[model samples]
Target: MRPAPVVLVSGTETVLADRAIRLLRDTLRAEDPTLEVSDLEAGSYAPGELLTLASPSLFAEPRMIRVDGVEKTSDAFLEEALAYLRSPADDTYLVLRHAGGVRGKKLLDAIRGGLGGGVEIVCAELKRDADKLDFVSAEFAAARRRITGGAQRALVAAFSDDLAELAAACQQLLADTDAEITEATVEKYYGGRVETTAFAVADTAIAGRHGEALGLLRHALASGADPVPMVAAFASKVRTMAKVAGARGGGNQIAAQLGLAPWQVDRARRDLQGWTDEGIGRVIEALADTDAQIKGAGRDPVYALERLVGIVASRGEDQHSPQRTG
Candidate 1:
């Protein structure tokens, strides 16, 4: 397949955009082993620099030029790029990356409108659970492997905050294991990382599983999870539960009122089971005290965290029990 004279890889999702560019580069290189590759930032180059780079090489070798941050490119650079697009070299492949903005709308439109037979590959951000799940599935599919649904969800939850990290994790799993990816496989590989995450600890504690919560807390700290974020996580969960418990109306309504995702509101409701208003209050109060201590007010932050976890897990049943305190 012949590469397009110009390709616009646009998106706010950096990881996806980067992967698209890499795939394009690899495809080009496979066709021509000596394909020259140049990665440039549009904003960093002066006027006419793009044209200079895209010009036919002295050795007449096939070339791929990747220009990132085109949305922030100067007017002069844009003008030069447009001019080059009008008469693009057959042997040169130009990749323009715009990170979803109005900064270079006109240029984007012109390119998409078919200037130099330009093609656009969009890497839009994956915000929904479905989209993320698709990404995970695609990653596995690329390796000619399949991941169990349970394993996919676990991987997504484990690296929910960072798509790049999620992709890296998926790639690592692919490289490390030849068998089909399963829930147990994901847990075996990422269980330690998941245990240390604040949400994991918070979930166990709020579910009133004292022993499990305490074990998770100890593992988290031992795995280098800081005391401050751990406390903050507990506080956040308690606050959400309190809000959901007190809010009137259906789950969707409460979710909107609290600015939480519907699933989050639903989970909060479940976590509120057997948690009286007084219990919620007590846990929140304990969290506040632990937060301050972890910050600086008291010594032995680790002990403070353990106490907070115990109090939360006990669900106000034994706020001052010797077992809890110890």
Candidate 2:
């Protein structure tokens, strides 16, 4: 027989992939240390190496081939692997891992196509809010920890939608606390600790509280808010200010652009009503500058962000205007 079709796993749900990989690796390692394990990356591999007998790696030991990648390897590799999976060898086990989405769906489809049977195994991703709850409950049960229903909801609410972070929180709670895992503990550990979202970032910037905005920015950066998303939020606020500055009415356009649908943009415009047209123009320019900074143009992003926030809060661009709004 040949080797098993590489067990193709993929998702943005990396925690799931990681947990599965850990279990498979440990189980195989415990079963046989001398198991010739080969880890192949999708991008780094060619289809020829996946073929048996003709290629090189023919050893006497029970060889397990594991492939991990950010994307599907290729059609050639998949086709070759499927042929191999038709009659997999007893001495070998093949496992493939991917961070799935639209990104690496080819491998998934291949596994589901022809070889999905007694000899083959396919584990698709668990999605939806309900599925996530079930996962959390099952994970705790597997770990022999008990969690209450309210506590579970609290955990999800407080940690946002990040499964990895939620798992970490659960593991930490399990390790640190001995209680039955109550809602109070979830509130204690993960409350007021929610991540900063794009909307919150916009709110901070528009409030013109430079110090708070800078602190929130730093906190967000530390909390895994990527620079691209954050700058996208900044761009949103800049576009709002630009439109509001150009108009005497239609604050709705400004609010819509800022993701503040149904919110009173006029109220916010009133706050910046003292800001001259030139001041708003400079603010827009500053946003562009900071966008470049966050994207790696400037050396110190934090300092650049702080500088930009300070200028916006202080309305420093007013000095450059030939006439003030008053």
Most TM-score-accurate candidate: 1
Q: What are the per-model C-alpha RMSD values against the true structure?
A: 13.6, 14.8
Best by lDDT: 1
Q: What is the lDDT of candidate 2?
A: 0.60
The pairs that clash in candidate 2 are 2-89, 10-98, 10-100, 11-99, 11-100
lDDT of 1 by residue, 248-302 (tens): 7544456678898654665676688888999888887888888888889987788
Q: What TM-score quantifies how close candidate 1 is to the native fold?
A: 0.63
Task: For candidate 1, give the lDDT.
Answer: 0.80
* lDDT (tens digit, per residue) of candidate 2 on 168-266: 778889889887888888778765453435435555656666667667777877876666666676666666656655554232334556555322343
| TM-scores, all models, native as reference | 0.63, 0.54
TM-score of decoy 2? 0.54
Task: Give the poorly placed runs of model 2, Cα more than 4 Å off.
Answer: 1-6, 10-12, 52-59, 98-110, 113-127, 194-326
